[model samples]
Target: MRIIGGKNALDASSVHPEAYPVVEKILQATTSTLAELMGNNSKIHSLNAKDFVDEQFGLPTVNDIFKEFRKTGA
Candidate 1:
């Protein structure tokens, strides 16, 4: 799902729009679709939060993203 009038496609998710790039990076690293990641705690757990860290999104943000994935549902 996407935000009705939002610029960032990730706005519909628990993840913030400003963190879109972080989500993109996570997807690329995991080679998984958004659908595949959502609500998949095991898969999300497999990921290393540190690996996804960057200047914009630090370890806490990445960990938050992982938390979002664990709880987000369709």
Candidate 2:
């Protein structure tokens, strides 16, 4: 769920198209770093890294965009 009354919540600059590339790069680096530190534990590693990104940057799943589109089409 989204933060209530949260600012900086949008697709443009809040999480823009351009920034996706950078974010992916950072996520990759983060995963690699964690894997190196924690070793090959896929479940724990993925969850930990995902939690970090979600907490810090807020990762939007495919459903988020689809929901917005559905609402706007009305």
Candidate 3:
């Protein structure tokens, strides 16, 4: 491997061939879990990302969001 650059930067290259098999196995395991959790709906998904944003992030209601930033607050 070669490392080059100043304190503010660096460059990179490919990993050794021997490491790919291990990475492939790890990826295979993750795919099955990902499929089960993220695919086919499978009778789940009662709520989604938008629901999370509305529930947790709490939409500030157009008025609440821009209110103070606008002349309303002024």
Candidate 4:
């Protein structure tokens, strides 16, 4: 679900709002946009979640972000 009045950025995934920054970091590291990444396990498999880990979002959260991107829908 998306936050009202927000950009509806998380509208299509199971990812938590707190993890958006992690997602952004992942997107920046990859060649694809969010649209291109979603549900594409081929792309997701190439990602190394450890590279995106931060103080707030650790390995588990980063892995979850990877899983969320592989989902076909919310």
RMSD per model, one decimal: 2.9, 13.0, 19.0, 2.3
The count of backbone overlaps in candidate 1 is 0
Report every candidate's CA lDDT. 0.80, 0.36, 0.28, 0.80
Give one digit per residue, the lDDT tens place, for model 3 in 19-42. 324323323533633223232343
- Better structure of 1 and 3 per TM-score: 1
The TM-score ranking, best first, is 4, 1, 2, 3
**C-alpha TM-scores of all predictions:** 0.81, 0.26, 0.24, 0.82
Q: List, residue by residue over 36-61, the lDDT tens digit for candidate 1.
A: 89888889988889998877788988
> Can you list the residue pairs that collide in candidate 2?
none
Any runs in candidate 2 off by more than 4 Å, and if so which? 1-13, 32-74
With candidate 4 superimposed using the best TM-score fit, by how many Å does residue 20's alpha carbon deviate from the native? 0.3
lDDT of candidate 2? 0.36
* Ten contiguous residues minimizing lDDT sum, candidate 4: 2-11
- In terms of TM-score, which candidate is stronger, 1 or 2? 1
Q: lDDT score, residue 23, model 4?
A: 85
Candidate 4 error regions (>4 Å): 1-6
Candidate 1 clash pair list: none
User: Candidate 2 residues 1-74, lDDT tens each?
Assistant: 33434452334223344344434544465564322323233432344324434433544542232233223211
